[model samples]
Target: MNKNLIIGQFTDAYLPITDGVVLTVKNYAHWIEKKYGKCIVICPSFPKFIDEDNFDIIRFFSIPMPLRPPYRMGIHYLDLKAIKRVEKIPFHIVHAHSPFSAGLFALETARKRKVPIVATFHTKYYDDFKSATKSDFLARIGVDIIVKFYEKVDQVWTVNSSTAKTLKEYGFKKEIEIIPNGTDIIPPENLEEYKEKINKIYNLSQDDNVFLYVGQLILHKNIKMLIESLYYLKMKGFSFKFLIVGTGKDEKYLKDLVRKLKLDKEVIFVGRIIDRELLKGFYARADLFLFPSLYDASPLVLQEAFALSCPSLLIKGSNASEGIIDGYNGFLSENNAISYANMIEKLIKNKPLLREVGKNAQKTLYRPWEKVIDEVVERYKELIFTYKKNF
Candidate 1:
């Protein structure tokens, strides 16, 4: 059987731009093209390069996003003229990533073309809205907009079970598929070299335990909480180096906090590193991964850490902690400073437990992209078959 596939995605951000959405989309697009020939990625044009043989990227004109909060909601103005360009192509499926302006345009195009529309629930926008706007009223408006936007799609997919539940709560009638993120396992040989490079950059000792934190420095990430916990440990005379990977709007604030708390020597913020292999190496070398995010939905970093057998310290109730079994593969703590500090102290006091948890974490294998793409392909086939039958 011959198949022609065109995927329409609306993301507030894309590559050269860092976030979970960009990572998910890039991974999905790469896997789909490798398996099914070619796929098109639609988003705002950024300076990043999308160099895949079978992938065609379409960037719509957009304004510069605000630097203070760091996202693509307010900055994007849907160029109906640019969107009109997609109408010229014969697309089979329209897949949107966000519920912002670009998503609305995608939905409209799908309806006009009479094609199947599929959307993936990505960001926890409502939670983010509350934090950025500080208005529950506005946050409610955002939730309503998301509900209305998603209601028009044929299929909805989420990265975690918690997000699926959230979709159902929002009055979505369609079945929401739960598909977690996946990563290519890093080889042991490469990890050793990566460790040496990282040690040289940070001046690390072989005896020192390095706790790594990878991802944005956002308020919702609750990185301050992690710094506070480290401060608490220092108060008790515990010594360890924290290697913070990635950068964001919170860099200056976090640096200030670290200095104010006298953790300048213990904490190192090694701003955003682009090399994927280097990131995987850091994951493998770390004694433990610290992610104290108070709000998230299945962050890819957690899965990356798991793939590398890096034990994690995650905050409870966050979507990333869903599949985690506390005390087995990682430790879960509340959002409070004391609770997080206590968990870190426990790990410091019991070194053997860390090794055991890392071993346990290695046992989990997540193949979400494979499974999700298979399901998506099957859905495409069904949609095409039904379209022919109906017409």
Candidate 2:
């Protein structure tokens, strides 16, 4: 077997996006370099700094995204230009993240270069379209675009099994691989100190149970539902603090709702904590992690919380639900605020259940990056071999 493998990864969003897709690709690229011989990452250029000498970066034109969440659609002209640049590189396999411009560009580049293309389904754009426009026609059109893009790739990889089933429903004939995103476990020493500092900073009392919500504060994330659940818990005389750790356009709106509900003392919005260690510390200290997202393929936050032994209350109708076994690892609830509140109340009433779920959740582990990369590399070799044989 050839030890030297050249892999090309393309995504529309990169660092500064502060979302799961960008972080997943960045982490995967770093792991590939550490485990494999060589790899290159292609993304739209940003003003922010990304220091990785081993990996090559191909910058392209990206439009300013407004109310689109983390995705800023890449221009076709710029993507074609990026495609040209990637075609010149010697890569054994091409891995595309987004099914829009970057994925389209990767498909073209792979076909021209005669390299096998592997696409990882990251975002649930169809779900986002529904939340943003609330138009079935627009969502259908979005689904059509994504279906066409993935039809050309050799192998499809979804972050979770539910996403894989979704891809199959969209007429994807290729074998779909379920490779859930993995997070580096936070060291115990770092987590312990981080917990004390964060609690003090947020003015969280030692007796008050703190529930953490860490992700983009948007309509799709269902932050309003989370706030309502907190209100419900308060009504029940549950002494708990809700920590909001993220920034988005909906920040002010969520804060307003908090005030309207008179949850001023109960809710704290700590915007965009960039430090990974500090974020993990908050996870370690939290009594429960709340994820009210209505649409998500595989949220890294849920995985991070699980890894840190923080039991979560994840909303149903998302790929993240694949990891939850109902009352075992975490609670899954309907999209409605009332339903979510019911779940929260259940957790508050049964504190022992929370600890039991968290203990069980720690056992549900994801495939290591080395194993995932090895599977990818083996797939690449098979593709190369088949292509050579046919030729």
Candidate 3:
């Protein structure tokens, strides 16, 4: 895979900015072009996205990050059409996902072509700058600019080990690979026909349930205590259904706090789905997957709700409650809104313990996407054979 390798990816977000670091940089340029190679992303300037055909983006000058909406901020000057498109593509590695402004433009363009770069510290960016600049001295200067960008990355990833102990308590003295993030969401051997077609498209009657909550309704994704815990599970009467897919900037302050706690007919804001076979039939017709984020570090929608079997409840020490063990397989909460309305009113009065923890979280928690892109192409061939045997 190194022979034709051209890999390069930098990112202050991309593609109309849809998060999870633009779906992990388009699944690392779609499995690094099915292992043959050639990537090149470099991001930020999205004046209405255009380029679309197996990675090769590159835009530059950006701006609007005031109280962040779709997070713009990518202005590290020096353009010259991004230095003649990285001087006609020679990069062998320069991954980075964001240590701010495309990790200082891939460390000033891989220090003028000496190449060899790597980074993937996904989130908890100092608790996202103390919830977007509420300032603890600006989240300690964004954790001293991510410990000087993980001391100019040569290696540093984190998908678990509770985010490598929050990147060594945010000083990151390098060496931190964990790498576990992948989801194509495949768990459908006729799961009750996607729970009777999501209970006849959300009208619900087959003993109504659904409690979903895909991601980003903002407020650091605690999502205003998950819409005030559905107004305390609709004042405990609990006639289920809370489905809030996605779309951010806190949609009109969480739809005016569900009409000021009236919970407007047991909350239902089914916004963004992005059709992955109808978002895997709303994660196989969810029965509970709330996710009360206290600042995530490793959450790709909790492995797309454990690849469609949906069992998430997570909150006990966020980072998606690493390998959850609350009630086992999943269900942890304790972050708030009366502890996520007492864990969704005790799994809505235990529907057979939420279908035996969603069938042990999809047959005992899974992981694929070609074994997480084969540990990112064997850490990109051991960082391109130790950067060409020390240059």
lDDT of 1 by residue, 1-391 (tens): 3344656555667776778888777766776676764567777765445544357777777666675534444223456566667777677777788877667767877788888777889777778778778999998787888888888777778887888877676666677876566664443555678777778778888778789999998877988888998899889888899999988887889999999999989998888878877787788778889998867788878878877778899988887788888989888999888889888888867778987887788676344466656766776667666766775
lDDT of 3 at 143: 90
TM-score for all models, in order of appearance: 0.91, 0.91, 0.36
RMSD of 3: 17.6
Residue 358 error, candidate 1, Å: 2.0
Worst 10 residues of 2 by lDDT: 365-374
List model 3 lDDT by residue over 71-173, tens digit each. Answer: 7888757556875776678887788888887887887777788878888888877767787778889898879877887787788887888878977887776
Q: Residue 233 of candidate 2: its Cα lDDT?
A: 73
In order, what lDDT does every prediction score? 0.76, 0.78, 0.78
Where does model 1 exceed 4 Å of error? 1-3, 47-54, 67-70, 73-81, 170-174, 184-190, 368-372, 383-391
What is the TM-score (0 to 1) of candidate 1?
A: 0.91
Pairs of residues at least 3 apart in sequence or in different chains that clash in candidate 1: none
> Which ten-residue region of model 1 has the weakest summed lDDT?
68-77
Model 3's alpha-carbon lDDT is 0.78
